[model samples]
Target: MDDQRRIFLATASRLGALAALTSASATGRAQNRDGGHAYPFSLGVASGSPLPDAVIIWTRILHDPLNAAATPRLAFSVRWEMAEDEQFRRIVAKGAASAAPELAHSVHVDVTGLRPDRWYWYRFMLGDAVSPVGRTRTVPAASGMPKQLKLAVASCQHWEFGTYAAHRHIAAAAPDLVAFLGDYIYEWGPYQLRHPKSAVRASESFTLADYRARYAQYKTDANLQAAHHAAPWIVTWDDHEVANDYGNEQDERLDPRFLQRRAAAYQAFYEHMPLRLTPRDFAHLRIYQRYDWGKLARFHVLDDRQYRADLACPPPGRGGSNSVQPRTCPALTDLGRGMLGREQEQWLAQGLSSSPARWNILAQQTLMAQNSQLPVVKEGDGRFWTDGWDGYPAARRKLMDTLHTSRASNPLVLSGDVHSFFACELARNPSRPASPDNPLLATEFCGTSITSPSRPQTRTEQYVSMNHGIKYGRSDKRGYMLLTITPSDTSAHFLVLDNVHDDASPIARAAAFVVRDGRAGPVRA
Candidate 1:
């Protein structure tokens, strides 16, 4: 069905849900054989893609969220209410959204006509049962400059590896926004050599139902649920959303059924997340949108996986992957090949150039800096992993060039998927370090994964040694970063967990850095 008809039906059902709030007859449609208990809100509630005037509130209804029989063919009417006060005494908006079975009983309420730069409390109701109360805030007015914004950066939470203790901490800290840079769910199935053995699933996620089951498993975690309930999220996908290291039309496995798998995965992603726009097609999702937090920040959310060029080098006798030296492979310098694609690149440039926010943040997936691992024999040359920005040199250079000329005040790039923290000064040329003549144009803060295993600490040190512009890095611990942005300065605290294997592990600060408002690079603070 089209969106307008679904929305209209949903709005009309609000009165029905309200009238049935005290009745068991209407709510019986939501019940399943789970020993006479309601579990429709198992996945919890979430809000995302916040704007000054509107925000998206979402929830899925299922008695058995982890299995396909949980959601039947019939639709369930759901009532949602928003209030300015936590007590819900001050009601701002009230509406009904139908949990359509076709959409996996997922409700996406694009709430409009709300105040800006303020906190709002909301909840969902079915019959007499109410969901957990969630807190979400809209952005400040476009022309106004807000005092501060506390944002939590997170990504790459592989379920089987560890528990989501980091998300629990994020919920308690209560940032204004959460930026998930992708790898929300890993595509690989259960593995034998993983910690916290409780999280392993039985099979890989290929079909739409399989993907939905995977998401349900992850969302079932109490800690991850708490974080979603705490604040609105701005999410973008990486390679794992569809397949492992899949680029453009190519999957790492190079299976003939990759396209169908991608379509199923995309549909499942849309059904699960709190997004404003629906996908136009299976492989085509307009997730690369923009957001503004008053005049203080403008976030350019980017999609780097769908339209990116395939990996540059397929090492001899194997599939398309691994690293390659620039001197040996001349194709590494192809300016025509891209990471963000041509259209996204243009859109990003235009947005960055025209934005009035004090901090122009490029929130994207994967590393943007050149992390070279060139052999000693090729000392002066650069070679890098074909999976990140290093694979698309020309595109990275163009992005740097755009940042240098943009009218935006402070250009900050937030990245994830590397499973390590990297604080670096973005240079137009990575072969040379930042100098007085070649000034640094932007700063990048790459957050570590919440539960995903980190690379060797030695590898992080190696990257730092190879790239002089990189100021600080650590891969020994797993946690998220809390970014506090003010008009005068923006600072990041790397919050690390003592032991992810232990759910009760204590969290401590690993490192901290600040970038002064006008400065183009990060300074140890």
Candidate 2:
């Protein structure tokens, strides 16, 4: 057997053993195609960008995802079906989707006219070969009220770091919605701890083809495939999706050719994702939009990287991750600088004011609460990470003011960029202390990465010490967050694995917090 085949079989065996741990059945079971061993659906399938009436079903027809040596330059006719039953007894929607080569033969079936708040199973077929069955569901009607909502927040699954044990856990949880807040695919080439039989490109991804190859490599993992096939997802990109710590049109490496690279990356991202909207131009790719789960919650998805001003503290082209005092950096306090741009900020403000849901959620890419990295003893005075909301103080203040003024109830923020779990309270007055007049404005739950390595453990003294708003924080292990929302309360559980390197790693809940109706902060539960 070829080395790649051997490695794939070994990983498949490990995943099969771990499959017993999950309650939900796994997807992406390989099928024999033709007399010859032709693997057409190698990347598996995904469904995302859901709505009350519409949901997208996606699959890429790739005979060779990792090695695109020879281009067939031919389009394939792919048939798709949506069923009300897992056994495919009653079919709801069935149609033929063309997998065009121009778009990498990726089929995105925008299934519409479906009933709200309903579950359905979907799958694809090419010739006599059948793809894995994927499960999907539509959100509740805009004016309707859902009694309960289960959302799994995940991010930063670096392929080289470890296996996607966390994603396996997410699939088993079977959340109604999965929110992926960026770093969906790492642009850099594979490094230490590359999985066995895993194909790693030698050079970093830059061109459209290079980025496509990287995505294919990551999608080959059965565990990740299971997670994607298990539920419908809402996705947004972070820095690693294009370039590390890239701001607006600026690249961290200070490369003049970065915009070309950015364009290619954006195109590839759109092609691979199950997005309803296609990119008109690489410079104008839009992913920020809103979704409502009936009257239960209104999710305002924001893009913080696309049209934002550059980093503040060290300034552009300085190549630093250190924090700075507000006095030291004049630009850090600039009110004109923005993270979500003016247009998106206005849209968010309008959404918050006009939202009719019981819970208002800001589902975005990065942390919104101010987090101090300084010593615990220096409580009120310290430096902070420039990459997060702390660098855009004025912008964050504007959001806080909007949330405080809006009529939206149980305002909450879900974030997943820092690769650390944080349960924090957004203060009404960000620049000042929290008091009765300026008390906790909203609750923020920042989930850790799906498989990304944890940051260096901070001193125990830092927990709930330096930052008055930080109710809990942990950077020791890799995991995801499970959020259960209802009319009366919203609860968040931090789920972690004992070891990600082991496919059968045990899953455990490290901590959990609850925010009751009318409460503005998270209380330990």
Candidate 3:
């Protein structure tokens, strides 16, 4: 059946749509009864660097990958084994856990007391058969620095856009951690696909089940799974995970209440992610968190939604995305007009001011530098852009000022979103600089999207030209970025995928940037 037809049928019967998720076939049980095989393992194991020492290991138990009659609801004791050597000659940590079908049989065990600044291999076991062996590592103790650190970032991966060829490239780089900047899944319409048959979106995800199904589908992709199995991943969410342009308390569309949708999104995000759940009573918050990667760098991963005020628009739109009377929005400078609520801001500020790490990296989303407003659009964009930090001038300024005054060493802002890629020297005022020596305290590198379609150089040139702050830009490609930080200089290379249209495609280097130590900005080389 076609994608649109699938949607028409699924929406026609909501309960039937759900029943299919739990459907089982008879061929599955017969093989299981007679085959006398070991347990089945499908979802491979993964780890996250939400903290040092502690690593979250995850797996999903399955009855069988080939059997249709096998139920996905089987509860099983998922066992984990971590070894020091790739040969498994020396085992370090061993643990056991259980996941019932009610929870999708997914398990996450936070393993502690492992060696830091070290590489480890792990596998999930059921009975006789074992899962695909995955590799993971822990951040060294604070004040400990690796001679080098390799990390990759990416966002906006719509299955319909193309294959995860970028993921294949990331796996080859052999990064210590994959810092996923969000939009791991796109809630796109099925009609958006040019290769319609490959990607089929039958339902709009709103409830927890829908969200989980979305994650499960993405998890099934070979490239995405390969990357996850290749290294521990650090993840955060962006608007598309819920709805596009849905920021703070505002929803651009009139379809769903922001908070209700947020709760569902968060629950599903945590369940599929390698995140250690922080059990809360009734209140829900997933906006802010920090990670210390040894003493080399401290990552302050933040949420710019939940607490943001309404948007600033000269004219209003259909929903709340970016509309005027956004004055209908509260005062953005209202101290309460927080993108990061007071509590999160305070936490971030304290972390920045007191961080002893050599590099304090702000691993967040959105373009931090100043973006052009008008005539520039006519020149290059062919359309005006006001979706991200550009829409919230006040919030952007506050964060910039905080960075300018802080003493953190080599403070660099790593961001995504804008679909397009932007590398800029973030100044107190990009249109004009106040001081040369203190050209402004930091640098901002905005990576491009995973599979989201972006404008070409023809469309982005004029915008970059008009916007004095932007040093470089490209919206034509879908790929990820490899940020290599060393004691001498922090270098970032945009790892562009040769093509995502083909499944077997390989990636190649597109560009590179080196922000030397003591240098306040990034210079393309």
lDDT against the true structure, each candidate: 0.81, 0.80, 0.68
Model 1 Cα RMSD, Å? Answer: 7.4
Query: Could you give the candidate ranking by lDDT, starting with the highest?
Result: 1, 2, 3
Clash-forming residue pairs, model 1: none
User: For candidate 2, what is the lDDT?
Assistant: 0.80
Off by over 4 Å in 3: 1-40, 62-74, 189-202, 279-283, 314-317, 323-336, 373-384
Clashes of each: 0, 0, 6
- Per residue, candidate 1 scores C-alpha lDDT tens digits across 1-525 of 863344334333332332232123123343434435555776678999998988999988865654658456788899999998767999999999998877888899998998888778899987666776777889998989988999999999998778778887787677889999999988766522223555655678888888887787677666777788778999999877877788887877777778889888988899889898865686676689999998899999999988888778766543346788887777778888888888998899899989988899999998887788753333338677888888888889988888888756899999998899999888888778788877888999999999887779988898788786688889888999999999999999999998787766789999999999999888887
Root-mean-square deviation of every model: 7.4, 6.1, 8.9
> Residue-wise lDDT of candidate 2 within 1-525, one digit each (tens)?
963354334334445643432212112233345544345677778898889888999998876655654336688889999998767999999999988877878888899989888888888988877777777899998888788999999999888677888887777777888999999999876632235344455568888888888887777676787778777988889888888788887776767787888888988888888888865787678888888899999999889988888887555555424478765777777889899988898888899899999999988888887776664343245676777888788888888888878867889999988888989889855544578887888999999887776666665237447677777888888889999999999999999989877776878999999999998888899
The collision pairs in model 3 are 25-69, 143-295, 248-305, 252-321, 325-328, 326-329
User: What would the TM-scores of all predictions be?
Assistant: 0.90, 0.91, 0.85
How does candidate 1 fare on TM-score? 0.90
lDDT of 3: 0.68
The candidate that achieves the highest lDDT relative to the unseen native structure: 1
Residue lDDT tens for model 3, 1-525: 963354333223432322222222111331223367523554345788545576888876655433312545567787888887656889999988887665567788888888777777788877665666667888877768767788888887887778777876676567778888878887654422122435565577776666666666566555666677667888877787787777665677655466787677776677677876663421265646788887778888887766666654524444444422223334422443446667777788899988877788888878887666433322123122345665565667677777766777878888887777788877665546437653667888889887878766776887787776788888887788898887778888876767768766777667788998777777886
In model 2, pairs of residues that clash are: none
